[model samples]
Target: MNMLDYIDWRGDLTFEQDGFNEVDNLVFSELAYTDMRDIVPEDGSRALTVAQVYGEYKAAGIDQSLMMNDPLPVLEKAAQSPRFKDITVKWYVDKIDTEQHLQFAAVTFIISDKLAYVAFRGTDNTIVGWREDFNISFLSETPGQTEAVAYVNRIAKLTDCKLIVGGHSKGGNFAVYACAFCDKDISEKRVIKIYTNDGPGFMNEVAESENYLSILSKTIKISPDSSPVGLFFLSKAERKVIKSDSKGFMQHNPYKWHVLGAEFESADARTDPFINMTISSWLNTMTDSNKKILVDYIFDSLEASGVTSFNELADNKWNSFNSIFKALTKIDPNDKTDIASSIKKLIASGKDVVISEKQKNAEIKKAEKNKVDNEKQE
Candidate 1:
């Protein structure tokens, strides 16, 4: 069973009776993608119940199915369910800035007077959103992450209620960042738990910082056992690996994640992190300047192709491919040459990293064998 099914089974119980579980964390995290612009107040002066929000959503012709991997059907059911129907949502913020290379959205679910969940929306259909995700490797803080800290601090300031920060994917990265860097009063006092549901990790610099370490005890990182996104830039910290109904990367979808009653179905462990580690090591090999050039070139190629949303790649595949191929003619020759050179260097760097890792592993294995042989002889 997944989140939608879990709602069918357990949606009747109130937070008072059941308390906020990881399942609840994900439900709210997923719903943060809902475009609440005018229906949900940005000022937090007023709020609307999930049912009422659904009505407004319908009236406004808001179709969330346009967004990538978004689950609007779940929201429809959530509106009808007893547990989530009356939950108030407020302080919705969605920002997309091409100049800043940003895509960020968040909404606060006021569960009760004493408790609230601040859920950040993850990567959407926007190219800018994906660009910000890539920026995570080279930049200390992506624009979305910076905004997240401010949003969390602002929400935490407005109420005395304890806050639970959560997000799926890029939003998960934001949730961790906001909780880690929020005001001392809010981080140490108001924020109770932070959940990053299959969210990618940060650069080693940010991951190793004191601010991030301070909230380690309060952080809950959960991922599908076969996760492709969450495993990227792999953080060595413990994560609760959950079983998924889908195979491979598609399991990144929260709805496909299996739920066993109130909790996710557990896996023995995550799938091997070898591929993820190699990608991380490859990125680490590049200087920040080189990383920026590659990041910009990739996104620039998408923009040159006139692709605005990722949905276009799926909905109109042949046309999108044709456009992408045609876009190469429009690129400046110098930029193309630069990108090609970067790729050549990347191939060389990747080979060295893999060879070094294999040799290190072989040494460890040889040492272990020698120790075992000596012990057996004795």
Candidate 2:
């Protein structure tokens, strides 16, 4: 079954939903153990509530190690079930932190015939929530090295585990971080391929670490054509990037990522030099000032008008969009009614405009050619 299907049918300690005949019951049982009864009403019908479940574990006085480590047995049991029928299957759940936030990662294992797969899910706030409150600038916190990371290390130690890791957004980032910081013995055991579907990267301090260097050989970073989270600065030891089709802000969503046919049909699925150059150019031009101004305007618009989301801001009678633009431009958020007109004039004047795609490619090609010529001259 697909990842979405697995999530949909996931109920309290069970998978009672239909169209799940092919999956093993033991797998469902193991998943069921992740349930928290208080999360859903007494109805007991909602999908697993991750934070609530984790809280229950905390209240029960389960030591972090036992709480985090217990998932291994559940997964191992599921793998041993007859339904796997000689297929290589494993289950693992772990917690990891980048020192800023605690993250619980649920990883599914399916290894058979040399093909290994790991599907991960990110818990916590959603991007839409962040976008609405977009004034936060860059993420200040990294997932801490709490019990979560230790748990992840335990799973990574599994012998004979090959590579195949996938996660949406933050989960993708966690998967990469785990693979990067794993103990050498565990690191050598698995991690052949990593699929970071539109996940954000760590700050330069974390991304360029010695631990990160070890796994740079096998990494695939994919981003939507016009992703917001994927637009931050990253320094990779090597280049292995994949491009997807979902342009504009829609690319941040996995549903959109999957729309590209088998997960890449609706997406461009290209690693074109031109695309890379265009992105680099924009990154170069979009300075911290631009980010701060835009984010500050978002904050002002939200605060001044008591608006919660973009939709609410749009619905408010304050001409919020223009107000935000004016705030960003430092002109006047509550100026004349010609907000759009003023913005058009600013663009025409080339004040805060980002570099164009064509210009970006030209610059990249010129740099490459210059490097080649310099080497020859030397």
- TM-score per candidate: 0.84, 0.45
lDDT: worst 10-residue window of model 1: 349-358
Q: How far is each candidate from the true structure, as Cα RMSD in Å?
A: 13.6, 17.3
The global C-alpha lDDT for each of the candidates, from Candidate 1 onward, is 0.81, 0.44
- Per-residue alpha-carbon lDDT of candidate 1 for residues 1-378, written as tens digits (9 for 90 to 100): 889999999998888888889999999998898888878878987789999998988899886655655557778989999899999998899899988999999999989999999999999978788889889988988889999999999998887789999999999999999998989889999999999999998888899999999998999999988766787674645799989876555677787898999999999665645444445454655667667866676577667667776655444445655554455456567556545555544435434433443454466579879999999999
Model 2 misplaced regions, further than 4 Å: 1-104, 112-116, 123-141, 144-148, 157-160, 235-246, 258-378
Q: How far is candidate 2 from the true structure (C-alpha RMSD, Å)?
A: 17.3
Number of the predicted model whose lDDT against the real structure is largest: 1
On TM-score, the leading prediction is 1
Query: Candidate 1's error at 208, in angstroms?
Result: 0.9
lDDT of 2 by residue, 114-180 (tens): 4445555543332133342222224433433232245356555543556555555555565677677
- Residue-level lDDT for 139 in candidate 2: 40
